[model samples]
Target: MRATMMDELHKPYVDTARSKGLPTYKVILKYPVRHAVTPLASTIGWQLPNLVSGSAIVAIVLSLPTTGPYLLQALQGQYMYLAGTFLMMLAVLTIIGTLLSDIILALLDPRIRLS
Candidate 1:
């Protein structure tokens, strides 16, 4: 976010907005901040899978009653149907996350079109 904002702040459009006498807060929020959010939105989409995978380890270590441990148990026991269901759920969740991010990106930036 910091890097993206820094890059955005230097762009000519931001400079143009500043030159137009917009207040600092308005200029920053209306320009660089809007552009800077794109990367963060995309990062959120990418993190969904990681979050689910990480939860499995965390659940095992903490001895929690959750889907993560159940998934691991199913896979270890060669329960193909149960294991496949879990895997399918993860895949669907990842696809949803990606689709949502694309929609959000399209809304945030004029250059992106859902087409």
Candidate 2:
């Protein structure tokens, strides 16, 4: 995120905003920060699945009474229906996360259109 912001700071539009005599804070917020956040919003969608998977692994390793261990057991036991349901849930979650990110990206960056 920091790297993105730093890169955005050097973009031509930011320079143009500065040259136009916009206030420093307004220039930074309206141009560079807005542009930098688009990447961060997109990344949040991808991170959702990673967070779930990481937590599942942690839950299993810690022997927590959670669905993570149950999911593993279901897979190992050949419980096809249960395993399929769990996978479907994960897919749904991924889709929802992506949808949310798309909405946020659209809101933050005028270049993105939902249609």
Candidate 3:
């Protein structure tokens, strides 16, 4: 991702920053790093749900009291309503994670909100 970000940066932007007497660190931060943050946040945001929920297989195998085992049991018992509710809850959490990522992105670069 860092390599891709570096490749995407416009040379003119770097040149302009350098011409303004910005040090290398400042120039990189103002140009490439800042611009890269949005996509990074987006990737992290989508993965946040999984991180928080943990691996269902691991949870079930370990007999943890988290949602995974309950969801599995609901499905196995043919309890459609309960299974659906659990699925919905998971979906909501994913949406919340994505929204959090967007908020972080906006905070990191206020220009995003303006556009």
Candidate 4:
């Protein structure tokens, strides 16, 4: 798998980081989530659908006061365009997020930078 190979290539940096008492996984975990707080892990975790689902639930709760119903109605009314826009946005976000993850991973692991 690509991840496995990347990890192997980065093993030296991982070992170095661990030797220095850093959470070496930070270099590898970014591929799946994103959080501005811990940019690396957060960015990698951002890609997992579970994070999106959690956000949606929070949004729904927050929207219960004023905007949720109206937005739901609008989306239901414009089903076709909504679907198209959602798909396009999803693809774009996915690509951009992955690239950000790769860049962060490479920066964290010097072995990756040499390549």
TM-score of each: 0.86, 0.84, 0.75, 0.43
Residue-pair clashes per prediction, in order, are 0, 0, 0, 14
What pairs collide in candidate 1? none
After the best TM-score superposition of candidate 1, give how far the Cα of residue 10 lies from its true spot, in angstroms.
2.4
Worst-scoring 10-residue span by lDDT in model 1:
45-54
The lDDT, on a scale of 0 to 1, for candidate 1 is 0.87
Q: Is candidate 1 or candidate 2 better by TM-score?
A: 1
Show model 1 residue runs off by greater than 4 Å.
50-54
Q: Model 1 misses residue 31 by how many Å?
A: 1.2
Q: Report the C-alpha lDDT of model 3 over 37-91, residue by residue, as the tens digit.
A: 7788878877866765677899999988887888889999999999999888778
Off by over 4 Å in 3: 8-10, 57-66
* The best candidate in terms of lDDT: 1
Whole-model lDDT values for every prediction? 0.87, 0.86, 0.81, 0.52
CA-only RMSD, every prediction: 1.8, 2.0, 2.7, 9.0
Per-residue error at 100 for model 2, in Å? 0.7
Estimate candidate 3's alpha-carbon lDDT, on a 0 to 1 scale.
0.81
Residue 13 CA displacement from its true place in model 3, Å: 0.3
Better of 3 and 4 by TM-score: 3
